[model samples]
Target: MTKLLITLLSFCFIQCQGQTKKNETDEEKKTRQEAIIKEHVYDCADKIHYTTQMYEYQKCLDEGIKKDSTIAYLWQQKAMPYYKARKYSVGKPFLDKAVQYDEKRWLSYRAFMKCIFSKDYKGVIEDFETCIKKYGNSYEMDHTYSFYIGLSYLQLNEFEKAAKIFKQDIEEQSQRLGEGHFLDLFYYGISKYEQQKWEEAIVQFDKSLQQYPEFSDAEFYKAICLMRMGKKEEASLLLVKAKKDVEKGYTINEDNAIYETYPYKVRW
Candidate 1:
C-alpha cells in the first residue's frame, strides 16, 4: 500500500531471509541491507522529479528518511533542491546529515558544493583535504580532490599555493590519463594569471584550448595575458573571437555551471 509500509515490509523480509541464512557473512548482510535501502529510497524518485512544489519533493524524501533514518540518499535528496534554489542555509543541515551517515560517499560532494555554491573556500579546503587523506586523491564532480583544494586557494587569493596545487594535479592526471583535463588546465592558467606570470598562464591556457578549441573562457584569459605582455593587437583579435564564441554558448560547460557561475568565468 503506502511507501513507508512497503519499505518496512521489504526490510523485514530481508531480515527474515538473513535469519534463515545463518552462514551469511557480515559483508553479505551489509550488502543486502544496502540494496534494500537503495530500492526503498529510490521508490520516491518519480515524485521527486515531477513534483512542481519543493515541499512535495521533500515530502517524498522525508517519508523515506522516516522509514530508515540511516539512508543517506534520502538526506541528500532532501537537501539538493534548496541548494539549487540558492537557499544554502536551509539545505545545509540536511546535507550535513547525509555526510554524517555516509562520509565516504558524500564528503567530497559537500566540499564541491562549498567551493562552487556557497563560496566557503576555507571549508572546501578542509573537507577536500580530509577526503584526500581518506581516499587518496579521489575525484568528485569529475575533478580530483586537489582540484577543488586548488580552486579554494585561488578564491582565497593564495595564488602561489593554487598554482602549486594545480601543477601537481595536472602532472598526476597527465601521468594517469595521458593528459590533463581541460578545466584543470584552465584554472591552472588562472592561478598563474593571478600571480602576473603572463607567459606561463598563456602556456596553460593554450594547452586548455588545444583540448577544447572553442573554450571561450580560456580564450578570454589568454587575450588578457597577451594584453599584459603588451601584445595588444593579438589580444584584441583573440578577444573578438572569445566574445563570438561566448555568444554562441561555448563557455565553461560544467554541469554545475548551469546552477552557479564558475570562478573566473568571463561574463562577456
Candidate 2:
C-alpha cells in the first residue's frame, strides 16, 4: 500500500503535467497507472532477493518460489536460511528439490546437511570428503569442511586421524585468525584429551583461558586433565570456578565442542 501510494502520486503528477497537451481521459489515465503498477509488481516478483533476518529471508524466498517453482537455484537459495536457522526439518524438502534440479550445485552441500541432521558422524566424514573434493576447503561458515571431517573422525574414535586434522586446522586458523582462537584451542585440546595426552590437553585449555578467562567448558576440561595428572588440589579449585561459569549460564557444546564431556558424543 505504501508503494502504491508513492507510485500513484508520481503517476498523478506526470498525468497532470500533460493533461492539456496529451488530453488524456480519466479512464486512459487509470489504465496507464494500472500498467505502471503491474510493471512494478512484476519487477518485485522476479527480483533475486536477500535478507539477513532468517524469518524475513524465508518470506522473501517463499514469494520467489511461488512465482517460479521451476527455478532450481531458488530452491537451493531457500534451503540455506532454514538450515542456518536450525530448521532442518523445514529445509529438507527444499534441499531435495534443489539437488533434484541442480545436482552439480547442491549435491555435496545437501549430503552434508543430511549427515549433520541425522547425526551420522561417519557419514559426515564421507560427505565432507566429497564436499572438499568438489568445492575444496571453503569456509562458508564457523567450522570449515576440514573441521567437520576432523570432528567426524573423533566421533568414530579415529583419534590419530582426528588429531592430525584437528592440529592442522588449529595451526591454519591460528595463522589466519591468530592464536588462542577459542574453537581452535578447544577442538585441538579435546582431540588430545581423547588420546590420553593429558599434559597437551591442559596446555590447549590454558591457551583458551588466556583468551577467554571465564570459559566454563575449558576450565572444566582443564580440571579433569589436571586431576588425571595428579594435581587434585588445583583441579578442585578450577572445578569450583568452572561451576560458577555454568551458574552464569555458560553451556558445554555437545559433540565437537570442547564444552561437553571428555569423549564428546553426538547429541541428536
Candidate 3:
C-alpha cells in the first residue's frame, strides 16, 4: 500500500510540472509577441509622421494587431493611414477592430467617415447603424451619423434611402430654424438630384434660391437637373445667368464646401 501511494504521488507531481512548463511557455510567447507588436507600431507611427504614406504604416500596424489584440489604439491609428491612402478595404478591418474593443468610439466614427469618402457605401451603412444604436441621442452624433448615412446611400445609388433621410433632416431643420431655410432646401435638392427626381430637385433649388439668391452653384445644379428633364429652354436661361454670375465673381464652387473635412474634393 505504501509503494502504490508513492507511485500515485509521483504521477501527480509530473503532471503538475508539465502543466506549469506549458503555461510558462505560453506566457513567454505572448510577451514576445507583445514586444514585437510595440516595436512595429512605433515604427509605423513614426513613418506616418514623417512621410504621410499611410499604406506602408498601415501594413506595419496590421501586423501588430494580428499579434496583440489588446492594443486598441493601434487599430484606430492603423485605419488613418489606410483611409488617407484610400485603401478602404484595408482600413475598414482595423477600424472595425478599434470599435470592437470599445475604447475609441469617436475615432472609429471618424475612420468610418473616411471610409465613406473612399466610396465604401456598404461599410458606411453598416458602421452608421451601429453608431446610431450606440450613441443616438447626442446632437453631434446624430448629425454626423445621419449625414454620413444619407451620403453613403447616395453614393451607393440607393436614392430612395437617401431621400428618406434628407426628408427627415429637412423636417428636423424646419423645427429648429423654421421653414424656407436655404440649408434645408439645398440638402433636399441634393437628395432629389441623387434620386433623378429632376423636377423635385428644381423645385427645391428654386426654394433655396428664394431664400439665398446668390447661391449660384445651386442655380448651376438646378440648370443641370432641368436639362436632364428635357427643359432645355429653362436650363439654357439658368446656364446663361450662371455664366454671367461666374464672370461677375459671384459663383461658388459647389464642390469646395467640405474641402477641409474630406481628403478628396467632392466633384459633385
Winning candidate number (TM-score): 1
Compared with the true structure, what per-residue lDDT tens digits does model 3 show for residues 82-104?
56555677767777677777633
RMSD of 3: 8.9
- Give per-candidate clash totals: 0, 0, 0
Q: What is the Cα-based lDDT of residue 193 in candidate 3?
A: 83
Winner on TM-score between 2 and 3 is 2
Better of 1 and 2 by lDDT: 1
Q: What is the C-alpha lDDT of each candidate?
A: 0.88, 0.69, 0.65
Worst 10 residues of 3 by lDDT: 257-266
Q: What is the lDDT of residue 202 in candidate 2?
A: 87
Off by over 4 Å in 1: 1-41, 49-51
Clashing pairs in 3: none
The residue ranges of model 2 lying beyond 4 angstroms of the native Cα positions read 1-67, 70-93, 100-116, 252-268
Number of the top candidate by lDDT?
Answer: 1
Candidate 1 matches the true fold with a TM-score of 0.86
Error of 1 at 219 (Å): 0.6
lDDT of candidate model 2 versus the reference: 0.69
